[model samples]
Target chain A: MMPTEDIYQPLLNVIEFLGTFAFAISGIRHAAAKRFDWFGGFVCGVAVAIGGGTLRDIMLGVTPFWMTSSIYLICTFMAQMFVIVFARSLKSLDNTWFFFDTLGLALFTVAGLQKTLDCGHAFWVAIIMGTITGSAGGVIRDVLLNNVPVIFQKEIYAMASIIGGLAYWALVELGCDMTISVITAFLLIVAIRILAVKYHISLPVLRGEE
Target chain B: MMPTEDIYQPLLNVIEFLGTFAFAISGIRHAAAKRFDWFGGFVCGVAVAIGGGTLRDIMLGVTPFWMTSSIYLICTFMAQMFVIVFARSLKSLDNTWFFFDTLGLALFTVAGLQKTLDCGHAFWVAIIMGTITGSAGGVIRDVLLNNVPVIFQKEIYAMASIIGGLAYWALVELGCDMTISVITAFLLIVAIRILAVKYHISLPVLRGEE
Candidate 1:
C-alpha cells in the first residue's frame, strides 16, 4: 500500500533530494574538468543543484524551495566532497552517472509539474515550468563553464522533458490520478532519453552562414 | 520645481528607460563583436537590458519587471538597429559609451535600492540588490560570450554600486528628501566609476595553481 500523503508528497521530496544530489555531482565534475579550484567547484555544484528550482519559484511568485531548507546546500557540499575523493573513479562509472542523470531529469520534470499545478498555474505553464526545472540547471552550469547551453546546441534533453510534461497532462486528462500520471510520465521521459542515446537520435544541427 | 508623487516615480521611469537603452546597446555591441547574427544579437541585447532587473524581481518575489511592459523589449530592438547602422563608428565613441554605461550603472543601482525598500526589505538587502542590478547583466552577457564575468575578475563597478547604495542611506538618514538622496547617490556612483577607471584602480587579481 502507498504511504499516506498517498498523493506522493513524500515521494516528491525524495525525488527532489536525489535530483539535487545528482545534479550537484554533475556540476562539480564539469567544474573539475575546467580546472576550477575547490571553492569554484562548490559554487558550480550549488548553482546547478538550485538554479532551476530557484528560477521557477521566482517566476511562480513563491519563495525559492532551497531557501526554506539547508538540505540542498548540504547535499551539494557532499557532492563536492564525493568528487574530491573519487574524481577518477567517478568517470569510470559512466553507466552509474548515466542512470543518476536520467533519474534526476525524470524526478525534476514530475516535481516541477506537480508544484506548478499546486500553485494554480495552467497545464501549459506547468509544462514549460517542468521543462525548465529539468533542464535550466544545466543551462546555468554551461554558462558558468563558459559554453553555449546544450539545449541551444541540440534539443534532445529539453525536448524529452517537454514531452514528459505533455505525457503527464495527457494521462491526467485520461482520468489517471496524480500518482499514476506522475509515475507514467517519469518512465516515459526515461525511456525517451535512453532510446535517444542508444539509437543516436537527435534534432538537426543548425548550419552556419555559407 | 518639485513634482508630485513626491517620491520621484517619474524620475525613476526616465532613468530606467535610459539605463535599459544603454545596457541593450552595450549587449548588442558585444554580440556583434562575437559575430552573432541579428537574432542572436537581439537576444543578447534583451538579456543585458533586462537580465539584472529580472533576477532582482525574482529574488524579491515579484513578477519580472519586463513581463509587465513591452517597452523594454522594444527599446532593446531599437538598440539593436542602432548598432547595426553604426557598427564601426560606435567603437570610435568610447567616451560616449563610458558616459552611457556609467549612467546606466548608477541609475540601476538607485532603482534597485528603491524597489527593494518599496518591497519592505532591510537596507542591507537593498544594498546587495543594488549591486546586483548594477552589474549582473554583464555577468550574464559574459557567460553568453564564453568568458569569466568581469565582476569575478575585479570588483570595481560592484563596489561603486555598493557605495552608492550606502550613500543613499546616509543621505536619507541625514534628513535629505528622497529626490535629493537619490540624485546624490547616482552622482556618487558615477564619480566613483570614473575615478576608478581614470586611476586604473582594481582589486588584486587572484593568482591560482602556482
Candidate 2:
C-alpha cells in the first residue's frame, strides 16, 4: 500500500516551487543587466535556483534535487525568458520582486529546517542547514559577480532564518502539530525579514582600521 | 608532555604548513593574473588555502580551521606579498608551482580522508570528503571567475584523490600501520596527478551534440 501523504506535503511543495522561481528570476535579472546571452542567463538562473540545495544535499549525503526532477530546470528557463521579455517593465516591479524574494527566503528556511530534522540531525544542525539553504544561493550569486555577499554586509538576513528555525524547534518541543509549526516558522521568517528591511535594521560590521 | 613535542606531530605540522603555503601561492598567482588588487588577492589566496577544509569541517559538524587558528591568515598574506615581490621570477617557474600544487593536493586528500574517518564516517563517505577537500577550493576559484571548473573538464583530477582514498582504505584493511598507509596514499595521488598532467591524459566529456 502507498503511504498516506502528510497534510503539509502539498504546502511544502508549493513553497519550494515559489522559492525556486524567485531565485531564478533574481539570477536572470542580474544576467540580463550584465548583457549575458539567453543560454548564459538560463545557466545562471538554474544555478541560483538550485545551488544552495545542491550544496546542502551533497553535505548531507543525498542526491541533488534537479537530478531527481526537471521542474527546476524548466522553471529557470521560464524565468530567463520572462526577464528577457519584460526587462523595462521589471524595473517598475522592484517591490514585487522584493516581496517574492522574502517569501522565498522564508519558504527555503522552513523547508531546509524540516529536511534536516527529518534526516535525524539535532536542532542546532537543522538551524545551520536552514540558514545555509536560505542564504547560500545569494552568496554564490554575489561572489560570481565579484561583489561582497549582501548577507555578509546587510539586513537581518541569516538572523531571520535562525529565528525561524528556533521558533520551529520551540513549537515542536511544545508538542504543536508539525503543520502548525511549519506555518508559524515560515510566517515568522517572512515577517521579520520584511520588518527589518522596512526599518533599515542591519547587522553591525567590524570596520577595522588598518 | 605536549603533543607538539612528538616526532610525528612535528612532521605533520611541517607538512601542513608547506601544503597551505603552496595552496596560497597558487591562489595569489591566479588573482594576480586577473589583475585583482592586493586585498582581493589576499582574500582569494586565503580562501583557496582554507576553503576546502572549511567546507569539509562544516559538513562534518566541526568548527572551521581558520576559526581555530589565525596562522592561516598570516600565511596567506605572506603568500600574496611573495607573489607580488617575485612576480617576474615566479612566472618563469610554472613547473615548480605545478610540483607544489600536486603535493598540496595529495596532503589535502589524506587530511580529508583521515578527518572523515576520525568522525566515524563510512569508507565511501570518507572518499567523497577526500575528493571535496582536494578539489573544491579550485572549483570555487573557477566559479567565482565565471569559468567552468577545470576538475569537471580536465585530466584525472578528482579521480586521483579517489584513488588515494581507496588506497588508504585498502591499506587499513590489510592491517598496515596508519603512518605507512597515509604516506603511500599521498604518494599515489601525487604520482597519478603528475603523470596524468604530464601525459595529457584527460577525461572525456559528455558532448552536448550527442
Interface Cα RMSD, each model? 6.3, 10.4
Question: Judged by DockQ cut-offs, is candidate 2 incorrect, acceptable, medium or high?
Answer: incorrect
| TM-score, candidate 1, chain B alone | 0.90
Docking class of 1: incorrect
Model 1 over residues A108-190: C-alpha lDDT tens digits?
A: 88788889998899999999998888888988888887867877876579888899999989999999887778788989999
> What is the Å distance of residue A17 in model 2 from its true position?
3.2
Model 2 steric clash pairs: none
Candidate 2: DockQ? 0.06
Q: Which lDDT tens digits does candidate 1 get at residues B1-210? A: 123275677776776677788899888888888999999899889888989888888898888888988999999988988899988788888787778878889988888898988887767678867887888888788888777655644447788998899999998889999888888999999999999899988754322221
Output the lDDT of residue A164, model 1.
93
| Residue pairs whose backbone atoms clash in candidate 1 | none
DockQ of 1: 0.13
DockQ scores for all the models shown?
0.13, 0.06
